[model samples]
Structure formats: C-alpha cells, structure tokens
Target: MNLLKTSVFNCLFVCSLIFFLFFLLLFPKESFNAALNGLVLWFRMIIPALLPFAIISGIFIRFHIADYFSFLFKPIIGTIFDLSNEGSFCVLAGFLFGYPMGAKIANDLVVDRQLSKNEGEYLFLFCNQASPVFILNCVAINCFKNENLFLPIFIILLSTSITIGIVLRKFFYKSLKWDSKEKVLKSLNDNTSPFEILDSCVMNGVDTILKLGAYIILFSIIVKMVEIILKDFYYLKTLIIGFLEMTNGISYISSLNTSFQIHFLFVLFCVSFGGISCIFQTASMVKNSHFSMIKYLIVKIMTAFISILYGILYLKFIY
Candidate 1:
C-alpha cells in the first residue's frame, strides 16, 4: 500500500511539474514578469517586515531567551496546548510574527532536542499564522477600508488558532508527550558567547528568508499562469489565485465592486488559510524535521472554515 501510494504521488508530482513547465515555456514573458514582481515584493515588503523578527527569533533561541519566554508562558501554553516551554516560545513567536516563523521555531526546537517529534508536529499545526500587523494594516484597514473591523478580525483569527491548538492537543494528548523535562530546563542554560550567537542568528535568518523568497517567486509564477488561464471567471479566478498566493488574492477581492460583507468574509477566509505559497514555505522549513505538512494543512483548512463562520456570526450580530 505504501509503495502504491508513493508511486501514485510521484506520478502526480511529475505530471504537475510538466504542466507547470509547459506554461512557463508557452508564456515566457508573463512568467518572467511575474517572477520579477514576486522578487520585488519580497525585497520591498517581506524582507523589511520579516527579517528583523526572524533574526531576533534566532537570537532568542540561540541565547535561550525563548526558553525563558517559554518558562514565563508555560502555565497557559502548557495547560492549553500541552507544549513545553520551548514549544510555548514557538507559539508566542507565531502569534506575534506569523507564517513560517512558527514552523521555523518548531523545527529549531526539534533540532535542539528541546521538543520531541510529536510535540513539534503538534505545535506546527496551529503556530503558523498571519501576523496581526498584516491583518490590521493590510486586510482590515487597507482592503476593507474599515479600521473597525480590525478588532473583530484579529479576535476571530486568534480565537480560531487557539481553539485549533487546544483541539489538536486533546486529540493527540497521548502521542504528543514531551521528552525529559530536565533537558527542556537545561536549554535555558546556554553558555554560548553573545557575539557568536548573534553571528549565527544573522546567517540563519538570511538563509531562511532567501528560501522563503524563492518559494514566493515560484508560486507567483504559477499564480500568474493560473490567472491568465482563468481570466473570464473573475470570482473563481480570484479564489484560485488566493489559494495559491494570499496577498494577491486579497488584493484582487478588495478591488471588486462587491458588497462589503462578502468582500470582508472572503478576505478573512484567505488570511486565515494563508495560501498554498505559505504552506510550501512552511513545508520547506520543516522539511527535514518530523513535522507533518498534511496535519498542518488539515488544521489550517479547519481554521479557515472557523474564520468564515465567525465572520458570518459577527456580521449578523453587528449589522
């Protein structure tokens, strides 16, 4: 059965790659322009926003500040998610910074042996999120043209993430057990020099950002091809693009002359989903680790559904 599954997957992957390459060859100019735009977006927005957080997160992990943070938040995180102090740090980072940061931090903890594979996999499910900054500024204020929606949207996303974390913890409680508590405690006692740690953090942060950028560019090309193919079906095209890359999807939806409620709900759903581009970036982050992309994808879809339902309830109550 395993061999059959692997063979089927390989065939699908190869066929998909071939189809993608054929589009690239057929529309060389479009593909090139899309790739360039993706690169520009990365340099102008993604790097400035994410690099500092990534570096600080690395420094925190290297100097064991994350361990201290984990310790401080352990009671709440432990009770809710059944994570150790280190895993708690991953959750905090995800809540604050968002996206592949959660996956990156989870991978880091797993690499350092602070979290067992099960714990890492569990954390990976809900820790990867869209940052509050993006939600408030881009989606709420800019896209919806309503700053009032910020609190509701933020609350919805946060509640959904926490709820999913708790649910996953309950479902996997037995399998998600931690390793030695002493080892987790000992991680807080790192003896590395500050300078060395800083250097390592900077390099690691750059490497991670670059890898993230590549995925963004590749997916941007794919999204562009998809857009070209589905130009007539604007609504469906918007959704498909959003499924591939979230920012583009949100921007497309916001430009439409739709009702405010419909626009808001779609944006909320896309932001909650975080797009296939983010999933691939996250998958890359945990590629060598024990984290399960399938599990993460399932939890993300659930969160997206929850976000839409919450948005509907909020709208009914508010207006």
Candidate 2:
C-alpha cells in the first residue's frame, strides 16, 4: 500500500513538473514570465513561514527541549491517551509542538528502544499532523480572517478524528513490541547562546516556507486554469483540485465568494487533504524512517474524510 501511494504521488509530482515546464515553453514569453514571477512571490511567502520553524524545531530537539515538552504533556497523555510514561511524552510533544517533530521524537524513541516499532508507527500516524496553532492561527485566522473561531473548532474536531482513527487501527492490527533499551539524551554546551537557537529557528523556518512557497506558486498557476474551467462547470472543483495540489485547492476554495456552509465544507476538505504539498513534505521527512508513505496517506485521507463528515454534519444541524 505504501509503495503504491509513493508511486502514485511521485507520478503526479512528475506530471505536474512536466506540465509546468510545458506551460513555460508553450505560453507566450510575457505570460510565462508573469507566472514565474508569481512562483517567486509564492516562494518568498512560504519559505519565511517554514524555514525558521524547521531550524528552531531542530535546535529544540538537539537541546532536548522536546523531551522536556514531553514531560509537560504527561498528565493529559497519561489520563486520556492511556499511554506509557515515555510513550505519552513522545505522543504529547509531537501533538503539541509540530509536525515531523513528533515523528522525529517517535523515531528517536524507536531507535533508542524506548517505544516499540509498532507503537512508534502508530504515533507517527496521528501525532505527526498539524498542531492547533498552525491550523487555527496560521490557516484560519491569517488566511481566511475567520475570527468567528471556525478554524479552531474544526481543528478540535479534526484532531479528534485522527485520534479515533488511530485507535481503531490499533485495535484492528494490534501493536508490535520491540526492545526497551534506554539511551542518554544528547546535551548541548552552555556556551551555545540563545541567539544561536533563534538564528537556527529563523533559518529552518525560512527553508520550510520557501519550499512551500514555490509549490504554492506553481499550484496557483494551475488553479488559475481550473478557475477558468469552473466558470463553465462549477461542480467539485474543490474536490478535484485538492487531490492534485492541496494548499492551492484550499486557497482557491477560501477565495470563493460562497456561503458560510460551503466555505466550511471547503475548509474541512482542504484541512483534511492537508494538500498534496503536505503529503509530499511528510513523505520527504519519513523517507528514511520506518514510516510508510501509503500508510500515512491512508491515515491522513481517512482522518480528513471524517473531519469533512463532521463539518457537513455541523453545517446540517448546527450551522
């Protein structure tokens, strides 16, 4: 399953790449250049947002801040998730801090023999998704101006879906056990100043933002075409566009002059899909880890579907 998903996504990415190149070649010089300009702008937007977070996240991990974060989430994790002490820490820190960070923590746990391989994989499935801060503050508030707190409510529901789905998977497959050997945490010298951490954070965040920005720009061009097509055929654009490029799909949907319910559904779908960009990013991170791209998609898609259903139900009864 994992291999199949990897192959499919890879094919899509390659096709997009080819199409984009063709677009540059076939379009008039001025139009192609304008699209390139847009792509550059998108890169600028995405890189800064992401690069600092990535670096800071790395520094935090290197300094064992993630371990400390794990400690803080212990009570909630212990009581609610019913996880082991160490397992709870990994899960909570991953859930609270950020993406791939949680995965990183889990990977470390697996490497150290603290968490079983199966448990680590399970943690990777659910815990390594978007944090509340990113989804609500970054996407909802910043992107959509949805001060009505729609994003937060949706994220709460989305997280619940992820958790439920993961639990169900665990119930069906059962978890595998491995060695439980403990390893000492790495230490950073005190001479490392706070500025260094800040700098690293900035650099990492920039890197992440730039990558996403480039993707956004490329996707925006494709979306422009889709919009034209939708002018004549306005059904299921969100669904089709999202499967191709997630963030662009979300942005396009958010830009629609639609009703609150439609907007809600669009947001639900966008968030659930996490966009193709997110899947690729996650896949890139786990390339060497024990994580499976296919499994991640299955989990991601299922959770996304559940979130969409929840949103639909909310619209039907509550909204």
Candidate 3:
C-alpha cells in the first residue's frame, strides 16, 4: 500500500511539474511576477516576523531557558498537556509563533534528544497553528474587511488547536509525561561562548527562513497557474486554489459576491486548514524527524471541522 501510494504520488508530482514548466514557458511574465511577489511577501512579512523569534527560540532551547520558563506553566500545560519541561515550552512557542515554528522547535528538541520521537509527534499534532499575524492582518482585515473579527477568529482557532491537542494526547501519548526517556538530552556546551550560540542561531534561522521563502514562491506560482488554467467550474477552481495556497484562496473567495455568512465560513476554513503551502512548510521543517505529515493533516482536517463548528456557533449566537 505504501509503495502504491508512493508511485501514485510520484506520477502526480511529475505531471504537476511538467504542467508548471509548460505554463511557465507560455506565460513567463506572470511566473516572474509571482516569484517576485512571493519574495517581497517573505521579506516584508515572514523575515521581520520570524528571524528574531527563530534566533531567540534557538537560544532558549540551547541555554535551557525554555525549560525554566516552561516550568512556570507546569500547573496548567504540565498537568493538562502532561508534557515535559521542553514540551511545555513548545506549547507557548507553538501557539505564539505559529506555523512551522512549532514543527521547527519540535525537530530541534527531538534532535537535541530533549524530547523523544513520540513526544515530538504529540506536540506536532496540535501545536503548529496558523500564524496569528496572518489571521489578523490577512484574513481579518484584508480578506474579511473587519478587524473586529480578529477576536472571534482567534477564539475558534485557539479552541480547536487546544481541543485537538488534548484529544491527540489522549489517543497518542496517554496520561504519561512526555520527555527524554530513551533519548538522552544533549550534553551542555560549557566551553561554548554566548557569541557562538548566537552565531549558530542566526545561521540556522537564516537557513530556515530561506527555505520557507522558496516554498512560498513555488506555491504562489502554483496558485497563479490554477487561476489561469481552470476557467470552467468556478467554485471548483476556488476550492482547488484555496486547498493549494490559503492567502490567494481567501482573496478569491472574498472577492466573489456572496452573503457574509458564506464568506465568513469559507475564510474561516482557509485559516483553519493553513493551506497546502503551510503543510509543505511544516513538513519541510520536520522532514527527517519523527513527525508524520499524514498525521499532521489529520489534525488539520479535524481542526478545520472544529473551527467551522465554532464559526457556526459564533454566527448563530455570538456574532
């Protein structure tokens, strides 16, 4: 079955590449602009938002600051999530930073042997969320045209993530505390200078952000291609675009002349799913790690439904 899946994936991947190449040859200007726009978005939004956090998160883990800080929430995350010192820290970082950061941190922790493979997957299942920045700025203000929607959107996303986390923890981790049981923690570098740690963090951060930028650029082109290729089945095209890349999908959905509730639910779904682009980004971060993309998608699908449920309740009663 795995072999069959792999074969099918390879065929689809090759076909997609061929189509992309052909389309690029046909519309060089559009592809170039798409790449350029992706780069600009990365520079303007991703870098400014991510670089500092990456560096600081690296330091936090390396110096074991996250352990101390995460311990503070032992009463809550500790007891409820039943995580270790490292996993607890991830809870905060995952929710706050969003996206691949959660996956990135989990990979780092697992590499350092501070967290076991199962423990990493436990966090990976639920911690990785859509960026609050993207939700507020892109979805709420730009797409929905209402900054006030931020609070409710936030509530739905947050509740869904936490709910999924708890459920997965029960199903996967059970009641035990997840930590470095078999995987011993990496030895602390006593001789390493603070400057050395900072330098390492900076380099890793730059590398990660660059990789993320490339994915963004690639997906931006794919979204553009979808727009150009499928003229028929307008709604089908919109769903495909949204499933592939979220920001563009939400933009397309919002531009249509629809009632507010329909628009709101669709927009809510996009943010909740975090797009195929975000999934690839997260997968990239944990490529060699124990985290499973299949499992991640299951979590995302579950969250999307949960979020829609919340959206309906909000629209029906709260909004």
Top candidate, metric lDDT: 3
Residue-level lDDT tens digits of model 3 in 173-243:
78444433465666666688888888988898998999999999999888878878786767888999988
lDDT of each: 0.85, 0.62, 0.86
Q: Which stretches of candidate 3 lie over 4 Å from their true place?
A: 1-5, 175-183
lDDT for model 3, please: 0.86
Q: In model 1, where do residues sit more than 4 Å from their true spots?
A: 70-72, 174-177, 181-193
Q: TM-score for every candidate vs. truth? A: 0.91, 0.71, 0.94
What C-alpha lDDT does candidate 1 achieve relative to the native structure? 0.85
Query: What is candidate 1's lDDT per residue for 234-257, written digit by digit as tens?
Result: 988998988888899999999888
Q: Kindly report which residue stretches of model 2 are placed more than 4 angstroms away from their true locations once superposed.
A: 1-18, 28-45, 84-117, 131-134, 137-145, 165-169, 172-178, 181-214, 221-231, 255-259
Weakest lDDT window of 10 consecutive positions for candidate 2: 178-187
Q: What is the lDDT of residue 184 in candidate 2?
A: 43
User: Could you tell me which 10 consecutive residues in candidate 3 have the lowest summed lDDT?
Assistant: 175-184
Candidate 1 versus the native: TM-score?
Answer: 0.91
lDDT winner between candidates 2 and 3 = 3
